[model samples]
Target: MPSLTLEQANQIIAGALARSKASGFKPMGVAVLDDAGHLKAFAREDGASMFRFEVAQGKAWGAVGMGASSRALMQRAKDNPNFFVSLAATSGGRFLPQTGAVLIKDAAGQVLGAVGASGGTGDEDEAICIAGVESAGLSAG
Candidate 1:
């Protein structure tokens, strides 16, 4: 199975931050995790809050652990609130079923990992993650 390289993770972070800056969103925190849901790289913009990192990582971790985009998880939560809420405790609070994250896939549709962002609306954060994945020559889902 193909794995995500540190260089690629850095590229994704840079791309996400650039897009966020271009769009005039608030300072952001971006996190990239490996297929195993391990932190690969992270960045918090100058003005972002310290808590942004945890929020960003939680969203990405949720995506990687569940094998789906955080947006999908968000919808699932809407359908099964109790189970989804329980999942947060199950993950020890590292999972966030929100719209600010996306799974990263390779050309073969293999899960490479996930990217997530915080410090903006859910839609804005998700947009940056998608842009980052695309800019890094990966697919976002």
Candidate 2:
């Protein structure tokens, strides 16, 4: 199975921060998780709210656990709100079905982990995640 190395994770976080800063979005927090849903790396921009870290982690956790982008999860939640809500409970509140997170996929399309961000609009968050994944030479699903 393919996996992201520590260097790749760090580069992704750095790229995400740079993109967020360039866009002048509010300070941001970024999180990267391993395929097992364990944290690989995290960063909170100097002025970002502290809660951004937890939100970012939850988004990435949901992506890795469900093997899908957070956007897809949002759609799934809309289709079955109760089920989705229950899933969040089941995951001990770590599963958040929101935009701003995506699965990290390898060349063969195998999930390696996930990246997520907060401290901007949902679209801005997602964009930074995509930029980060691309910077690491990985695909964002």
Candidate 3:
């Protein structure tokens, strides 16, 4: 299975930041994770809050772990709030059901990793994530 390279991760983060800046969003924090849900790269804009890092990481972690976009996870949580909340606790608060992240898929639709962002509305965050994935020439799902 092919994995996202460090160069690719860096590109994604750079693109995300650029998009966020262009949209006039508040300073953002972005995170990229490998297929195994391990951190590949992370960046917090100079003015981004400290909490952005963890929120960004959790969104990416949830995407990689569930093999779906964080949007999907959010819908699932709405249908099963108890289980979803418990899942967050079970993952020790490392899982978040929100729409600021997406699974990274290769051309063959293989899961490569995930990208996530914080410091904007969930929609804005998700938009940046999708932009990053596309900028990296990967699919976001």
Candidate 4:
């Protein structure tokens, strides 16, 4: 089983920030988490709110815990609001069923970790996450 390395995590965050800047998005926060849902790397762009870090980490943590993209979790939340709400509590508010996060997978489709972004619109944030994963030579799921 391939695991996410600190180098890769750093690359992901760098790529995400670059993309966000090139796209003219607002100041952003990005987070990378290992498969165990541990923070591997994180960054918050200048001018971003202090809360952006928590929001980014929460999205990635939820993706890692659920073994799915945060976008998917958002859909699930729509279908089961109560359960999803409970899950947020169960995770001590570390879970966020929203867009802007994706599972990081190897070539063999093995999940290595997750990456998440905040401060932009959901679509913009998610796009940067996918871009970051690809920039790191990994797949986004």
Q: After superposition, how far is residue 96 of candidate 1 from its true place, in Å?
A: 0.5
Q: Rate residue 110 of model 1 by lDDT.
A: 94
Candidate 1 segments exceeding 4 Å error: none
Reference-based TM-score of each model = 0.98, 0.97, 0.98, 0.98
All models: lDDT? 0.95, 0.92, 0.94, 0.95
Which regions of candidate 2 fall more than 4 Å away from where they truly are? none
lDDT score for residue 89 of model 4: 93
Give me the overall lDDT of model 1.
Answer: 0.95
Report the C-alpha lDDT of model 4 over 18-83, residue by residue, as the tens digit. 899999999999999999999999999999977898999999999999999999999999999999
Candidate number with the higher lDDT (2 or 3) = 3
Give the C-alpha miss distance for residue 130 in model 3, angstroms: 0.6
Q: Write the per-residue lDDT of candidate 3 for residues 1-141, one digit (tens) a residue.
A: 698999999989998998999999999999999999999999999989879989999999999998888999999999999999898999999999899999988999999999999999999999999999899999889
Report clashes for each candidate as comma-separated counts: 0, 0, 0, 0
**Sliding window of 10 residues with minimal summed lDDT for model 1:** 44-53
